[model samples]
Target: RRYEQRIAAAARRAADRWAGYARTGDQIDLGAEMRHFALDTIWRALTGHPLDQATERELDRIATVVAALPQLPDGEQAGAAVAEDLARIDAVAHAAIAAARRHEDGPDGPGVLRVLLDAAELHPEYTERLIRDELVTLLVAGHETTATTLTWLYLLLDREPGARRWALDAGPEGSPERREAVQALVSETLRLYPSAWILPRHALTEDTLAGHRVEAGTDLLVCPYLTHRDPALWPDPERFDPARFGPGGSRPAHLGGYLPFGLGARACLGTQFALRESVAVLELLLPAFTVRFLDRPAGAVYSITVRPDGPTPVVLAAAV
Candidate 1:
């Protein structure tokens, strides 16, 4: 709730850029556009400023490193592969930290970076390096996940166009019913495409697992994708139905039934914020413009996060 104003501001900027597309008759890559909007939103929350293209271009190395992580050779080769990218990421992070230390406040206000800087004053433990790590983590976690989820939401709406009409028809703009419907759209998209498809966990002691045995200190992977799509847990699991997240909808009752943001304490802290940001953007865009897909992705690529395998070229037009 504290971040609502910044989220709305960010969404307005993105909506303006999108409106330009509708006005100019230019094609755009929807995936990239979503990424930009998300990056801008989180960047504002983190540093109280919009994401400039120059900084965003350098920070894009974060995605590059993430994608290359699974393919890198073992040991030192892995570090070598992403060394340049890491340096680039570090430069941006340190710059932000320095700015925060200087008490820089963006147009919105002082962001979380300012808070972290203040904490450092009272505690010696909050070192510069630690601050940098926190910023970068916020960037990767908040930016990539929300961006990808939104891209998937738009793609899903492209396929299930009726869902759009259903949502818009549910209630008037700015109404609670309309907001719920919009959130339902984001929820269903997340069910189909969780930010972190595979969450890594480890066993503290030996235990039985689904009628199988587990060894102490064993590494485990919890796959929310498979769990969310289990036909037993979700009837018609593969279907893109936003109503599933609506009131009286048949969402599973058990704790493990739905874990888009993971479960327990380790669950994403920004879950609510992400939903708010998504809804904010959708509220402004959904009723204003209709995206016409000029180039749809043929498949999905599952790396650090699952995303459209190819570019998503789209043209924006005034909603009829």
Candidate 2:
């Protein structure tokens, strides 16, 4: 309960910050703002403190490292390419861990770091380095997925304007119907642009898949992006149709047919958190403001994650 309250409070702070920009008609980078919002939420959960601008700036290196991973050579070469950014990220992580070790809770409360620190007292394995790794892992996983999903959701809305109206008209503000409608918007957006589009798995033993034989130790990439768009799985696959997730909407019955967050036991841990935060922000912003893009991205970037290939500059206006 306490944790939930802290997350909600962090989200409220993010919404309030965005509302200030929207009210003044400020031009903002939609993707960047979403990143900030997500980082804030996760930081609070990890440290019980709202994310500071300095830390946020330092953490930008995470994105750089992630973008460069696909093309960089393995081992030393890859390490050399991102060595500086990795150092910055490491410095931030160490600092946060040290602070958490001081046993000083943030304004919200003790965070996951504090819990880890407490465990370190009894468990010798929870070394400072391990704690830093956990912190960085949470930071990366917590923000990037949600940020990309929210950015794509807005972009999709820009292309399909009627969908926004359809969602808003579902019911009054804060109503379950409206929330469900907004969630459907998110679901459809994810179908088109799942952040973690690819999942790789290694075969443990020889097996047959779809009448094809697979040898043990073989590597395979399970691409949710491709599966979500398969013509056999989705009718008019390229179409941006939120109705596909709404009531009375027709969809494939197979679990493998639509897995924006992967499938089975190893699915994303932040699925519920991501959906809740996305809907919370949209619930406020959708009814109160409409975004007009000054310029849109050229296309999608296929890398560690699928993302808009360019900047998402936009101006915010009060909803009419």
Candidate 3:
């Protein structure tokens, strides 16, 4: 219910902004636009505020910090990397907690923060600090992965006219058929260019992944990009064919090979959320514009998350 209200509000804001750009015929940054969409949605859904001026600046700064860190370093210094992120998470959570406390009198549960605050009342052990940790995790994971996916999706669709046309032909956001098409597009994009290209795991005990024997404590790096592109599973892997995911195309028997979101209990909690968010934004954008990518020799840069090294420029002409 909260998510729906927040999304509806954000959609209104997006439509207004989109209208302004349409009138001016001005080039808009879709990446930045989607970033704002995610933040605004969170603001409305989680915080009960529609992102005040100060909060917007802080969100932008947070995005920058995450982008700068790339990914947490593994090995001996892993502790330090975690500590750094924890500090950032702490700051964001405290800000949110303080804001929620000021407005605790409201009805409708007062958004996600208030929900946590309320939970703390019932569960005596649920402390404010614990609430902060969870909120920090939710915000970072919710924002970064979805934003990266949306940016990459825009870049890929901008390069492929056929995919863009198919997406545009899919009905509006509320249409079930349209939602399925959007999901296929998102799935195919993740297969080709996953936001978290590499997912790391440790062998709890002696085991084997595929044919490789894993000893206890062995660090296992599962490369989704490599596996998703493997000719054994995906034919003509280089091609941008959303049809590859349609009922007809082949899929690997070992679906585990492609891990955009990790597998088992450790997998991303926001997997469903990210998919929904990406599809929603794509459904909105695809019907409105004829997207064309500006020429650039860009490829993925390995970080904590994979992202385009520079701006993925595109021209969004009106689909008239």
Candidate 4:
């Protein structure tokens, strides 16, 4: 409960930041702002403190490293290519861990880092290096996925303006109907452009999958983007229809047919958190302002995650 409260508070802060920018008529990079919002939310969860601008700037390297991952050579070559960015990320991680060790709590209070630190007292394996690794892992996984998802959602809304109206008209603000409608917007967006579009798995033993034989140690890539768009599973699969997720709307019943966050035990741990934060921000932004994209990306860049290939510059105005 306490953890959830902290997350909500952080999300509110991010939303407030956006609201301020909207009121001032500030031109904003929607994708960058979304990234900031996600990082701020997760940073608070990990450290019991809101993300500082300096730290946020340092962490920007995460995107660069993620973008470069696909093209980089394997093993030592890859590590060498990203060594500078890794150093910057490591410096930030070590500093945060050291600070958490020195201070029992941050401004908001003790956070997940404190919990890990507490465990270190009894578990010799939770070394400082391991703690840093965990912290960085959470930062990378938690922020990038949510940021990309939100960015894609906005881009989708820009293309399909009626979908925004559909959600706002579902019910009054804060109403269940409205929330569900907004969630459907996100769901449909995920259907089209799942952030972690591909899930890689290795077979441990000989097996059969969908009439195909797989040998032990075989590598497999499960692509949700492709599955979500399969016409056999989704009617008019290429269309952007949030109603597919609305009450009584038609959608495939098969679990494998639509998996934006993967499936089964290995599903994304931050699924609920991502949904909550995305919906919370939309609750405030969607009803209050209309975003006009100054320039839209030509296409997507598929790498560690599928993301807009270019900047998402936008201007905002108050909603009538």
Candidate 5:
């Protein structure tokens, strides 16, 4: 219920932004727009303060750094660069924590930071830096995945009328059934264009998958994009059919094949958060505007996560 409320508030803010821009027939950078909404939501729900313009810019910079790291050369060079970015992010996160602790009396809230702060009091050994690191992890991990998913969802929905109609009939936000429909669309979209398409795992013990033998200490790679479209698992997989998830539609028997958030305990903790966020944004935005991707394949660039090579240049016109 708390997550739902946060999503509602974010949706309202996003809607307002869209309204203001729609009046001028301006092109809104949704990447920036989504970041603003998510940052403000995280700030208020977690730290109890509204995000100021300056903080928003900081958040943008953090995202930019995160989105750029994976593009760096592999090896010690990349490690050093990542350390520098993480240090910067850590500094910002600690500052936020310090600011929150000054005013916060005790933790009795839904924000992850609040919960962690309360734990900090009991476990004094858990330094403020550690708590901040965990909080930063949650914030970056949670919002980045959701933002990318929203980017893909809008880009795909804008091109498919039938998909859009189904999304509307199901009503994307504030409605349970509609939420499920939107979830289906999100699931399908992620299957086709997962933010973390490539997953790397180490073998705990010698095992075999699909008749391939692996040594005890071998590294393994699973590509969700390929597995999701495997003809054996998905019939006519290239087609974007949300109905494949419907009650009567055919779905793969293999559970791990469609892992946008990875599999097992190591899977993303904020998977649900990201999904709900995407659905809420879609519900609010779709009713007010017509979204369509620009005529060009926005190639995926794998950084820390998968995102378009550039701004997912799209046009969102006021829906008449």
Candidate 6:
């Protein structure tokens, strides 16, 4: 795949960080490390450049704002609460756009930004503001979701050490079997904590079938996080079992099931990208290191995304 080399490079950079912790026996914040790694991966894919410290520092506010989103007041007041952080995020976005415009063919080659810029030539609607919005969306959605899933994945693996060995034992690194196992791990993680756990939709033209009335103007939310855990759809749904997706695995008997990526036409476009990059990083790190969490959150936090309520600090042990 065109993204294989890029994903590998990003994964290697992340692996190096874990290797450093392994050598020093230092406790690292798993959540922070995963977030950084994910940002770097998506940043490179968007602009063909690695995430530098200065930019990453600014982008860190993305999390702050995202966390506050659920609590913030609606409308104009919402902007006031996160104004400073939004400004910083916007600054970073504009800078990236200008840089991409100047260097359409970046060091790593043309990236998603370049493609957007090229389209602006024929479509005037792709204004600077729109470009910035897209960049910020890709930055937040691309990295944040991936980072959360990975953080959860390792946490789950720590609780179930055998699962890590099971994935590694599926086959050697880069083998199809191993990849499948790694994906299963990610699939399970997402099942438990789906990205954008709750998605809101508006009714343009109301219609209903299950003995319910129709309203032309109404808001509805679809929650994959809830559906993924439905006992009826997923037997023993609370268990973190990846075998549900393995060969000969039995899926929910009901036709409508497992909405991890979501449901219908507007489902996540980056399902494949997210899964691939996740599996890529796991293929490298899972085999190379074992993490012992210094501390685990007492529970999960529900916000723009569902994540561990507290910090995930861990010490890594490199495999012998």
Of the candidates shown, which would achieve the greatest lDDT relative to the real structure? 1
- Deviation from native of the Cα of residue 32 in model 1, angstroms: 0.6
lDDT of candidate 6 over 236-320, digit per residue (tens)? 9899888888777777866457776776788787788888899989989998998889889988988889999999989999996
Report the alpha-carbon TM-score of model 3 versus the true structure.
Answer: 0.84
Order the candidate numbers by lDDT, best to worst: 1, 4, 2, 6, 5, 3
lDDT of 4 by residue, 195-299 (tens): 999999989999999899999999999999999999999989989999999999998888888898888888998888888878877887798888999999999
What local lDDT score does residue 159 receive in model 6, on the 0 to 100 scale?
Answer: 79
Please, what are the lDDT tens digits per residue for candidate 5 over residues 279-319?
77777787678765555445777656777667755566788
Off by over 4 Å in 2: 73-81
Per-model TM-score versus the true fold = 0.96, 0.94, 0.84, 0.94, 0.88, 0.95
Cα-based lDDT for every prediction:
0.89, 0.88, 0.71, 0.89, 0.73, 0.86
The candidate with the higher TM-score, 1 or 5, is 1
Indicate the worst ten consecutive residues by lDDT in candidate 1: 66-75
Superposition error at 167 for model 4 (Å): 1.1
The CA-based lDDT of model 3 is what? 0.71
Candidate 2: lDDT of 137? 87
4 or 5, greater by TM-score: 4
**Which wins on TM-score, candidate 2 or candidate 3?**
2
Question: Candidate 3, residue 260: CA error in Å?
Answer: 1.6
Error of 1 at 298 (Å): 1.9
In TM-score terms, which candidate is top?
A: 1
**Which is the better candidate, 2 or 3, if ranked by lDDT?**
2
The alpha-carbon deviation from the true structure for residue 124 of candidate 4, after best TM-score superposition, in angstroms, is 1.3
- Stretches of model 6 off by over 4 angstroms after superposition: 73-81, 253-255
Per-residue lDDT tens digits for candidate 2, residues 207-258, read 9999989999999999999999999989999999999999998899998888
How many residue pairs clash (N, CA or C atoms closer than 3 angstroms) in each of the candidate models, in the order given? 0, 0, 2, 0, 0, 0
Error of 4 at 207 (Å): 0.6
Q: What's the C-alpha lDDT at position 129 in model 1?
A: 84
**True lDDT of residue 150, candidate 4:** 89
